[model samples]
Target: MYNSQEIVSISNRNIPSLITLPAELVYSILDNLDMLTILISFCNVCKRLKNITNTYHRYKTFTILNLTHHRINEQEFECLVNTLQNNKTLIEIHLRCNKIDNQKTKSLTDVLKTNTILTTLVLSNNTISTDGAQYLANLLNNNKTLKELDLGWNQITSEGIRYIADALNNNHTLTILNLQINNLGNQGTQYLTNALENNRTLMTLILSNNCIDYEGAQYLANMLCKNKTLTTLILSDNRIGSQGVKYLANALYNNKTLTKLHLRLNRINSDGAKYLADALHNNNTLTELHLGWNDIGNQGVQYLSNALYNNHTLHILHLQYNKIDCIGAQYIADALQKNTTLRELYLACNKIKNQGAQYLLNILKNNQTLTTINIQSNKIDFHEIQYLIDILEKQRIQF
Candidate 1:
């Protein structure tokens, strides 16, 4: 943090000051600073400082520029993008919660078209709608190096998604796409899945809270039958009822690529859990399954517990906020005795009382594979929690 202007002005006279620090010391300082500070201020100090910055390996490798929630406006955002236009080392830029609108998105698109190094762009929680999406869609066609794009919490409608879907057909580098909380209903989901059938590079697709129901899920199920690259699909907070779950479960039987599926808050009930449980019986590829905030009761938990007996691949299972009671907890506890591959189990916000809690705590003595087990917000009182803590040495138990 040396003062650059008065490098020689002890003038008060001519003594060597901290501003005359060596290149090595300056490089060490650059290692800890963000890209904005290094580029906008440090690099502008002098020719010597700029040269030292260009050669700083630590600075060069610090590629991610995250300005999330900075609340930057149009002029500031344009200036920021313009400053980063020619940066070759930055690979990711996060601008979430900024006040970027359609015009600012255009500025970003224009800047990103020529920047070959940047691969991830997160513009979530912004004000960009349909027109802004079109700008980004156009950028996708020109920028072949971008690998991840998060446009969640926007108002990009079904119509805007069409442009992105069309662009995906030709785009080969983008791998992760997050469109969560966007009002892209069934039609948008259809467009994206149709394009994904041919696209091979994309692996993670998040479409949570999109107003999609059985019809939209059916399209995705059909696409999953043929697509062999997608690995993670998050469809939480939709209307993917039991019938929708049925379609996805059938697809999972054939899908050998997907490893994670999130269907929380989808209005799924006992029938839906049964469908997914049946799929888990034969499907060995999925590693994480999130089914929280549903009505998968004791019967549904029983069905899933039975599947866990034979399943060897699943590592994480989230059943939180479901209508699971003491019986459901017992079912899960019984399965843990034999299921060694399962590592994380989430049973929060359930109705499991002392008896059911004891069952799970006792089984943990033999089940060493479980690294994480969340039992918070359940019906177990503080005394039972303290009892478990004493037995587990406060090291193994996390309540």
Candidate 2:
């Protein structure tokens, strides 16, 4: 006897009670919904559904940047803010490459001030300049929940980094910070390095593609000698050559926590490699080292090979596109025979011909640890490929 619209309303009203769904189940369903869809569908539901959807577990991980590069806009972001403002359950928000400006950053920070649950925030590749970054740094000074932050590829310079460094001294929860590709130069690196001497929570840092030269690198090296929590440091493409790299190698001799160091595409040559080899001989923690795209030829490889005889922690070494020929490949292969830890090696696009390939084959035949070797685009022949594949198959069977 009821009208169609009336009946629809009654059914919608009774849907929650009729289902007898638990609160946890409702949360799980909302958690699987995308940000935009969560806003649309959950908001359209009854007040109870809206309340349940606003909980922390429902929309905790907001990944604005997926691999496809479909970034969010300001209005949509604001819609998100408005939807979650009173919810107090959001935890992580990733806003990579969304073209956000200072105004939006300010607005976002204002909302973040009330957001007690958000512990991880990533705003990489968004041109958030010094002022914009400072706004977030200010939030960090008081934010208790934020434990990880990434502001890489922003326009934040030395002055902005100083603000962040000041916050880092007192901020205990933050463990990982990425300032890579930012304009944080010598003065900025100096500030950060000095503060790191006092700070203990920060465990990993990426400063690649920044304008940090010998002075900046030396300052960081000094800090590395003292800092205990930091394990990974990336300084690739920084032009920190022999002089700077020697200081870093000296620091590595003393630093116990650092396990990975990336120095790719720098001007680090045979001289720098010698310094690093000396450090590797004594250092026990460093497990991965990337020195690719440098002019570290046969001489450099020889020094590194000698270190490999003593170094047990290094499991992966990348030496791709470094002008290494069969001579350099032979030196590396000799090292592989002694190195039981090295499992993966990259010698791609180095003009390595049959001679070099044969040397690598010999290493693979003896070295049980070497599993994945990239000899792609080299001057390798069919015989070399067959031999390498056979070795890999044999290893797979053993594993």
Candidate 3:
């Protein structure tokens, strides 16, 4: 419809410029271009290109880099460490289940000295040796930004824990530390808890599956008496028997900061429950107690139930797989009628039959604070509990 010259002029305006391309495509083009071309030759020629360059630079500033299960070896991880040297915005580095070992731990930890914003470094489930913990210890000694360091499921032994304990003695910024399932025997726990005596910043310390018994627990109890900062302590899957709980319970009588204590599968029996109950009677800060799977029979529940009548701070209690029968269910039901603070009670995998279910049903009608109750695997028929569930709000009961 137009002349050749007029049509050619209109086509010139319709031609797509590099700035009009897709964002990813433009970024790819910039990645291939040199600095001089980006700054002087190409980007300066277009106003939209400058805006794209700003986005390009912003996209590269990674704050939370999660390269989990990437199998990144020492050589590949060295490049990441080099990038972190200049990355001030990065706060968390999760290289969990990577191929990191003890040989090149220096390059990995050396860059942390220059980084000021990184707060969490999770390197759990790695092959880092006991020797590698020395480098981590060095980082923790002077680094100020790191708050939580998870070195769980590694091969760090007693000697390695000694290195970390020495660092804790001087470090002040780190708060949450996880050293679980590392074969840190009582000797290693002794070294770590001894360091905790001087530490002022740490709040949560997890030492689950560390082969710790009463001797290691004694060290922690001793530290808790003097250290008033720690709140949550998890000692699950260890060999801490009745004596270990006794040692910790003795500390709880005076420790005003501790709120949650997890001692599941630690071989605690009726005697251990009595020790904990005695402490609960005097301690006012503890809110959650996990003591599942330790064969604490009806007698143990009686002890805990008796304490609950006076304990007003506890909100959650886990007693699953503790051999609790109908008698134990009655004990808990009686306590809930008077106690008004508890919200969740996990009693799964017990021997609570239809009679036990009825006891809980009668109490749930009157108890307003108790919201969640897990009675799964308690050998009770659904029909036995459904009639009660129909009367009250069924949302609180988990069969």
For each candidate, give its TM-score against the true structure: 0.87, 0.85, 0.87
Compute the lDDT of residue 307 as modeled in candidate 2.
95
- Across residues 1-399, which tens digit of lDDT does each residue of candidate 3 receive? 999999999998899777688878888887887543443344444567656765786434646777789787554565566555555567888878886788656777888876789999998998777789999999998799899999999999999999999999999899999999898999999999899987899999999999999999999999999887899999999999999999999999989999989999999999999999999999999999999989789999999999999999999999999999999999999999999999999999999899999999889889999999999999999785677889988899998
lDDT (Cα, tens digit) per residue for candidate 2, span 1-399:
999999999998877761357778876776676666777346545767676655645354543323114466655777756665564545667778888777778877877766677777888888788788788877888777888798988889998888889889888888889999988888999999999998989988999989888898899999998899999999988878888999999999899999999999879889999999999999999999999989888888889989999899998888887778889888888888888998778888787687887788777767788877887777777564575557555443211
Instruction: List where candidate 3 sits over 4 angstroms from the true fold.
Output: 1-61
Candidate 2 colliding pairs, count:
1
Q: Write the per-residue lDDT of candidate 1 for residues 140-167, one digit (tens) a residue.
A: 9999899999999998999999999999
Q: Which stretches of candidate 1 lie over 4 Å from their true place?
A: 1-62, 382-389
Can you tell me which runs of candidate 2 are displaced by over 4 Å?
Answer: 1-34, 40-49, 55-68, 384-388, 391-399
Write down the lDDT of every candidate, Cα atoms only: 0.88, 0.81, 0.88
Residue 309: error of model 2 in Å? 0.4
Model 2, residue 289: what's the lDDT?
95
lDDT of 1: 0.88
